[model samples]
Target: MAFTQIEDYGVIGNLETCPLIGNDGSIDWCCFPHIESSSVFAGILDDDGGGHFAIQPSGEFESAQEYVTRTNVLRTTFETDSGTMTLTDFMPVVDGVELGHTTSAIYRKVTCTEGTIELDATFEPRFDYDRVGTTVEQTSEGVIARGNGEQLYLWSPADFESSEGEEEHAEATETLRADETMWFVLQYNDREPIDAADCAALLRETIDYWQDWTHQCLDASGCPFEGPYHDDVIRSGLVLRLLMNPQTHAIAAAPTTSLPEEVGGVRNWDYRYAWIRDVSYTIQALNELGHEREARNGFDWCLTMCHKDDPGEIGHPLYGLHYPPEMVEEELDHFSGYRHSKPVRIGNAAGDQQQLDTYGELITAIYTATDYGEEIFAGEWEVIEEVIDHVSGVWTNKDKGIWEVRSEPKHVVHSKALCWAALDRGIKIAEDNDFDAPIDRWKGERDTIRETVLEEGFDEELGCFTQTFEGETVDAAALRLGSVGLLPFDDDRMQSTIDAVMDHLMTDEGLVMRYEGDDGLPGEEGAFVLCSYWLVECLALSGRVEEAHDVFESATEHLSPIGLFAEEIDPETGEHRGNFPQAFSHIGLINAVLYLNQAEPGETLDPIGRGATEITTDSKS
Candidate 1:
């Protein structure tokens, strides 16, 4: 029903790439070799048509799944009328011989849990989403599925059937009479085969690998928690770190493909790309947990994507796997979208938009990186100087806001405040780094932005900062005005702004939306998960720790039973929407928990949480 809602899926990846595993035990969406490839198994889009790779008990089975401790090793167990079986999914993490953090490969294994149970495994490989077709060969080891230009080999147990174009009957039959075991191996052509006997041994190796790396945050996890939802906040941070591109150092939105924003709503766009606006919360989350690698990757992407060299040059509102300026947007007209949300696009059209707040986010990233003991890029600093100079010149002009609504542009308050913050942080950077910038010019522009916002951005009658200048509509984004420090939380404007957003933007579920009136689309969407966390953060910053914890706990109620968060949640049915296991949602949770902890010290927070906040705040002082 409703295409199972986007957020119902759990993510498994080898840093080089990721594949989403839905609750149904199917590999619903998977891109080979990288996060941005044609789907090999995409049951997430069409349960019947879209191909899938799954292994569970054939008969009726009650299911439970969890990641094994610190590693990405996933253990999903199914209890049926016959017996119980567990599927261990993971990406292989190899350390360089010299030591430190470096990944090599990933491996997924399936095993027998407590009771030996027969399993039904199915391998339906649909190359290129719709099916350009793969050359399937019955290898001595298993079925080697090969697609044109895609060398990913899918090896399953022998006896798997096939078809000419769309392979459907490729099933792994298990009779419950004895213990049955099966493994699916998807590997690039250039590597040697991994020696994995059963899924449990591989699961053990993967767990050790992740524990070794995540052990670095063992202390950070012990921080006092703010609410009942502490574990969720921490793991979200870990997910963000893993999603970042190690090569380009950019963080993609979700390591997924074609998981539509609206089910059958024709609003499906590829979220496997990065946006600085999204990374603002991401940076804060990583820094709080002391996760340096992901924090630095976020900063790297922000610097490259910010158009800091020419901030006024129609800044790229978003980016794909890399930060190339000319990366064009195109729609995949062939494949039907997840839940039939058509116009499945790979690149982002928001790249050329003028979201004024993005530069401010860039500033926040750099400043936070600096504060977290990270090295600032020499080239990026030069570009940032120019970008800050540009913001100083045109802080009042507005083209598009953060939501990137397709409608006409307006003077959005969030955009203006970020502009002010960009200049303010730039001034701080220039002073700290002893760089010669147009200081006098920047200060004047910053002053103007502050005054203009106080006068025009505030609604006197509503006693709060409106979404747009003097607009009555309160926005969930307004919660960031204080979070970004354009105004202090004690200010009446900031407090009222939070109140107005909560009063207007919130639904009965306690989640929020971007705005009330319009978002340029026709159908109603789910509650914005990030916006709700912003409310939690706002509550904490406003010295309402208990309230913030309460809100945070309420938000966690929407998580799928397996501890995964999505982009949005249904207002009525409480189902999740947008992409599954979205890093933005998790990062928001991490940052909010940090604010709650700062507000009050009560629950002992595990410093080694997956979503470590100290890492996001690391910078080069």
Candidate 2:
């Protein structure tokens, strides 16, 4: 099997879970039942033990892949020596508003568009993360691969034969002329077998469903985003939605884990779990783009996760998708890593670490969604108060920062700024709704946090706000002060800090690094993509419109062909690093575009809202 670069894959999902379909026609990585579940196909991580399902031309062929317009359905064209064939891939969904709640089946239709072409289909599933082998059993309907309490059934119109001894693997070879079509359906869990006609009908319905949803985005008239990357913005929004869990409305940071921040390095971590701070950022971006309903759904999901039976035991920085409290880190020693990036991790330890920034993120998300006139339940309001009380009590202490640093605790500047934001937004929420208690106390704490950040987080000698209190390390998080409303974007102090961070922490290739300081990690990582977008937003807000445009262009120049981005980018190689199709990166992109477009002179733009709260059309004229 030929291995492709991580960027060569396009993602297709059922809103429950997704699979990464490579340009070469391979489903590289996928987790079923839920995003965090063990992968049935882990070839993206370990080609041998990590089984894969692939359909491609038998002979050598050149291939190109793309998503069907306005939908998650993917189409890969294979040009063989004698002919051409196209493979259409999508997970089936029910009709209407129920489209998001999808069935556990992947529908693939293969057709020859040119002369006669020979096609090959391979089904190899790794059960229990390859801890056990799946035994393939042939039946009248098709073939079923069963192992470890998971059963994946395959039904195809073409003849199937056992490739390995004892029918451990199933393969099909068929020749089709122009206008000929064949169907393959891969079903997981409890599902009824379907025929080719039903598969074709479901495919059409799925395409229509996605197309209608994309049309509903803010792209209609009065939509603010009209720029060089308009289509990219829409596509990123779709990718973010694809990462969301339909049942809980909780969004995963990414679909895959252990893809590596640096090849041949140990920076791999599982990103399938939901992080409160990450979801909060995602919601804010969606809300700014006029996807208010989706944003509120996500925020409401976070509220539900935090509000357990015990109100005192409120929120954690991160949680598993199904099991919120038990995020135990585990290493898979049996499987090889992606391109030799070692120690494939399962769960995240960051869930247990006390990151003080989460409170502020939750409050800001709720306040932003509510400000958009979306209704908030009384139960949500109670959770908001509990979070506020928690922040007021714990802002002074620090365990882990936003980066989830494994180092000793220090007063991280970003965490403190977020704590201030929590109080600041809480006060605003209280005043806006006239629902209150401890108004003066909240005000004093907010002001105290502001003063402390100004005094201790800033380094006069360096002319920038440091990463931690009284520390000299410049970080990209400083650029976010404007977004959180902690500082005026054009304030001289803030400008100095931005300039300093860009000067010291940015790569020669114009990409921003998260931080240049050591955090007890072994290998060096790539420039952070989210931070690059933050620089874009910060520059636009500070009145450097042209510079911001230039920076935005440079930052997005090397994204995936489909405009997807990973968490980080290697400046030298221009390859995606860390988890692929990262939510934070796309969220940053959408918010930055909104900030730039809404930043016209005489028009005041709210960075959080991503649009003018008041357009001031008369002043513009």
Candidate 3:
């Protein structure tokens, strides 16, 4: 079988890991045990060697996928000439139950709603990204696949037959009539057989769990849940929720990695780990949606992972869910890449890069949480002080900016502005709570950084801020200066910067590219989806509500039919690129919608935290 289109897949997860199920009823990508663990089924990456599990109608059929209302339970309907069948897929989640107490199982319930339909089920488990050999065994209860010291048990009523060749797999066939149903449960390292009754109960509980969780957005006293883009906001919220690890509170950038930013390019990198910048963005969005508990948990997790005893030692940009400091990049040469995008990678080497923007983003996240009435622990405050002091000492240094370019570090204006934001927020926290050390020094550094950015970062000839100090190139990240409070939204320089980005970095389709400059990598990448949303936010906050709405609608029109977004989009083809269901993209969508909904027709809005809080207050009133 050929590779499925990246947008043709729907995601379902149990907070530990996620599986991408194509509309054709094939689970093409899944990482078991943990989101960062080796793949159990990775046919999406390599159509030939990477294994997959599929259940579909025997003959040609039309299929469509959708989520059960306000829930993550996915329902894919197949319509054939003879009958119609519905496949309900979900990883069962129960309230109040610890993740360790339950078996991490994927439940697929198939129901024949009309006439009769014959279905084919194929189970191929490729442990360890298809590098380790796996053996399939038939059992009385179901089937088992063992490899790389890991075992997967497939429980079903249909009698599955195991193949005897080198590329081993199991196959089964079932025919169901009207009102008939069948169940398939794949568990990790567990042999407990689950019947149809168990599946039915679990399905109901899972639906309730998601629906109840979603309802919190609407039920929260001060959130602006009722808006023109309510459905889009809710779906984006759900996607962001799926990327969060409930056990570890670490929010992954995406589940599957190395999906490529371009079809056959080398821009692929593993995003299964949590980055401080990404997590901070996710927390701010969750806070805006009134999901304070999740926001607090994510913030706390980031602090716990990045905390250091030495004041001078700064944390890495990203870390593993288990809090590993370094993620050594490795390539899997055995399997073919997605669409032959070779050199499929496992870990992210960029984790160790000096991304100075993290200090500002993390401090801004802390300030936002406190604005929502979340108290900062004493130790966390100390860490914040150390971080601010470190930023004060290093704001003049050169480093990789927000995009994590692999080129030599430069004095990125955005990074410097973020460092200024870090100091500004740190001083606010210290003053707001009467917990202080050296406010005068922080203020001095903050003012100096601002003046420096305004002077050296701005290009007089371009009439806007450039990507680097004294550079002449425009970057989409410059659009964030106003939103981060580095400048007022209506400031002449800020407005000119926004126009510079739109004219230089935006595609014909209105999607924004990160930059047109080289990033020390080969091959071109697609227009970044998150950067496009940043444009939407900038436009909205600057009182250009109609323009913002137009850009937002144009960008969201490219969202998958099921409302999921990848990290980037091919502007020419409107196809998704990069990792599937990116948290950054979804977080951008939520914040953009909130900003658009709150912006007045002729007045500039405040920066993110303050502006978002005003909407909550107005909604409550």
Once model 2 is optimally superposed onto the true structure by TM-score, how far is the C-alpha of residue 371 displaced, in angstroms? Answer: 1.4
- On TM-score, the leading prediction is 3
The TM-scores, one per candidate, come to: 0.89, 0.94, 0.96
RMSD, candidate 2, Å: 3.8
Q: Model 1: per-residue lDDT, tens digit, 112-189?
A: 645657666676677777557666655555566666666555555546655454453356575443355556666654
Candidate 1 lDDT at 281 equals 64
lDDT per prediction?
0.69, 0.80, 0.85
**Candidate 2 global lDDT:** 0.80
Least accurate 10 contiguous residues by lDDT in model 3? 612-621
Query: Alpha-carbon error at 281 in model 3, in Å?
Result: 1.5
Tens digit of lDDT per residue, candidate 2, span 420-473?
888888887777677755879988888888788888888889898889984689
Better of 1 and 3 by TM-score: 3
Which ranking of candidates, highest lDDT first? 3, 2, 1
